[model samples]
Target: MEQFIQDWGYIALFLYSFGGGFLALAIAGAFSYAGDLNIYITVIVAGVSNFIGSQFLFYFAKYNKSYMDETVNKHRRKVAMVKTMLKKYGSFMIFIQKYIYGVKTLVPLVMGISAYNPFKYTVLNAIASAIWAIVIGYISFTAGKLLLSFADDFKYVGFFTVLLVLGILVYSFKDKKKVKKQ
Candidate 1:
């Protein structure tokens, strides 16, 4: 991973973040925290990648509206709810779509297919991407830093903690079963 990042630089970061989603962005952040990459550059690349990928999906949905409509029609309630939200919120929906689970791809595509202004979508998406990148990147970087700090100690402590939890769970299950049998 380090080697790939080192060799490919920002291009690799862009590609990875494009398809890899949040997990990929987090990994990039971890690398940045580890001093293998630059955090600011990583965040920018991640934001751009997310924006491009989302736009691609939006265009695809826009171009294939008929087929998408067929699929969307299968879930009328969900589609209606999302449409209502988009109608009420407009560009704000696009800005915060990335933060909402299950709607990241759908919202953008829906907006595009609905002919919601492309300029607004683009502007809001760009802003959202930057915010997402900054927030997620910082979280992953801090997590990575903490994990590295506790690397050696966590190995032993984590192992025992897992064992202790497992033991308690097993004991509780057995006690319940024994009571039921009695």
Candidate 2:
């Protein structure tokens, strides 16, 4: 991973595309700190990458609404429940939905089809993206620091293991809620 980071310098394409969310954030954060904050290149990179990925998903949902509706119709009760929740909660659903594995991709698109306002969409998504970037970036940055401090020791392995576990747990909970909604 270090070699990969070294090779690309500030670009974390591989990590953003393939790494688990937490790992990507942690690495971005660590790199930002390691570079001494001369500029927020790492943060901006991670933020932009994440925002682009998320917006792609959102656009997919927007474009594929009919298809998704057909798929969701296979379970009408679930769709009805989601619609009710979305109606009752308004824009907060977008923020809450990001915790789920793929719902981040879905909510914005789905909301676009609903009564949600575009201005609300812009505000909610931007805020959510910023928070997500900061949280992930900080974790990655701190992970890098820990690895540096204990370079010769085996604790770095444990640190990463903990990160992996936490990520899995968070994803799992999100998935579980999605299943329940379905």
Find the candidate with the highest lDDT and give its number.
Answer: 1
The top-ranked prediction according to TM-score is 1
Backbone clash pairs for candidate 1 read none
State candidate 2's TM-score. 0.59
Each model's C-alpha lDDT? 0.80, 0.62
| Over 4 Å off, model 2 | 1-3, 9-22, 34-39, 73-85, 147-152, 155-182
Shift of residue 158 alpha carbon in model 1, Å: 10
lDDT (tens digit, per residue) of candidate 1 on 75-152: 778778788888898778877777776677678778878867778777877888888899998998888777556765
Worst 10 residues of 2 by lDDT: 13-22
Tell me the TM-score of each prediction against the true structure: 0.72, 0.59
Which residue pairs clash in candidate 2?
Answer: 26-139, 26-140, 27-140, 29-141, 30-140, 30-141
